[model samples]
Target: MFKEFKNFIMTGNVIDLAVAVILAGAVGLVVNGFVSDIMMPIVGHFAGGLDFADMKIVLDEAVVAADGTVTKPENAVMYGKWVNAIINLITVGFVLFMIVKAYNKTKTPPAPAAPAGPSDNDLLTEIRDLLKK
Candidate 1:
C-alpha cells in the first residue's frame, strides 16, 4: 500500500495536478487583489464613488441600550460584496482566456503530413510513358 501510494504520488498526472492547483491559487490571489485594489477603485470613481463592497440591504437595525451592556448586531444582505465577487470572477476568466489565446499563438502547428504516395493515375501514366518509349 505504501509503495502504491508512493507511485501514485510520483505519477506525472499527480505532479501536474499539484502544479496546476498551486498556480491556480496564486492566480486567484492576483485576480482578487486586482479586483479589490485596482478595478474597484476605478469603477467606484466612474460611478460617482459608488462602493460595491459597502452595498447592503439592512434587514434589522442594531439596538444599543443606554447602559451599553445589551446590543443587537445589524442584519443585512451584503450585495456589494457579491457584486465585487462577480467582477472578480469575470476578470479572472477574461485574463485566463487571454493568456490561453496568447500561448496558443506561440505554439508551432503540427508538421504537414508527408506527401501521399503517388496516386494510381500517376503510376498508370508513368507506365504508359515507359511503354511508349
Candidate 2:
C-alpha cells in the first residue's frame, strides 16, 4: 500500500498538476497586482480620478455617541470592490487566453500518418505478374 501510494504521488500527471497549480497561483498574484496597481490607476485617471474601491452605497449610516468617534460602523454595499474584482477577473482571463494562443502558435503540429500498404489481392496480382515474367 505504501509503495502504491508512493507510485501514485510520483506519477507524471500528479507532478504536472502540482506544478500547474503553483504556476496558476503565481499568475493570479501577478494579474492581481497588475490590475490593482497599473490598470486601475490609468482607468481612474481617465474617469476623473474616481477610486473604484471606495465607491459604495451606504445602507445604514454610522451611529455616533456623545464622543466624536462612531459607536457603530457604517453598513454599506461595496459595489466598487465588486467592479474592481470583475475587472481583475477579465484581465486574468484575457492574459490566460493570450498565453494559450501564444503557446498554440509555438506548438508543432502532428505529422500526417504514412499511407497503408497494398491489399492482399494487389500483392497476389503482383506476384502472379512476376512469375509470368
Candidate 3:
C-alpha cells in the first residue's frame, strides 16, 4: 500500500496538476494586481475618482455612543470589491484566450500519410514476368 501510494504521487498527471495549481495561483495574483493597481486608477479617474473597492450599500448605520464609541453594523452589501474581482476575471480570461489562440496558430499540421506499399498481387505479377523471361 505504501508503494502504491508512492507511485500515485510520482505519476506525471499528479505532478502536472500540482504545477498547474501553482501557476494558476500566481496568475490570479498577477491579475488581481493588474486590476487593483493599474486598471482601477484609470477607471476611477474617468468616473469622477470613484473607488470601486469602497462602493458598498449600508443596510444599517453604525451606532455611536455619547463618548464617540461606535458599534459595528451587522448588515451590509460589499459590491465595490465584487466589481474589482469581476474586472480581474475578465482580464485573466482574455489573456488566457489570447495565449491559447497563439499556441494553436504555431502548431504544425500533421504530415500527410505516406502512400501505401505496392499490393501483393503486383509483386507476384512482376515475379511471374521475370520467371517467363
Off by over 4 Å in 1: 67-70, 118-133
What TM-score does each of the candidates earn?
A: 0.82, 0.85, 0.79
What is the alpha-carbon lDDT for the whole of candidate 3? 0.91
**Per-residue lDDT of 33-118 in model 1, one digit per residue for the tens?**
99999999999999999999999999998888999854898899999999999999999999899989999999999999998999
lDDT tens readout by residue for model 3, 1-133:
9999999999999999999899889988888888899999999999999999999998988887789888765467999999988888899999889878999999999999999999999999999999999
Model 2 pairs whose backbones collide: none
For model 2, state the Cα shift of residue 4 in Å. 2.7
Candidates ranked, most accurate by lDDT first? 2, 1, 3
| C-alpha RMSD between model 2 and the true structure | 2.6
| Count of clashes in candidate 3 | 0
What's the residue-level lDDT of 114 in candidate 2? 88
Q: Go through the candidates in order and give the C-alpha RMSD of each one to the true structure.
A: 4.1, 2.6, 3.2
Off by over 4 Å in 3: 118-133
Q: Report lDDT (CA) for all predictions.
A: 0.96, 0.98, 0.91
lDDT by residue (1-133, candidate 2, tens digit) is: 9999999999999999999999999999999999999999999999999999999999999999887899999999999999999999999999999999999999999898889899999999999999999
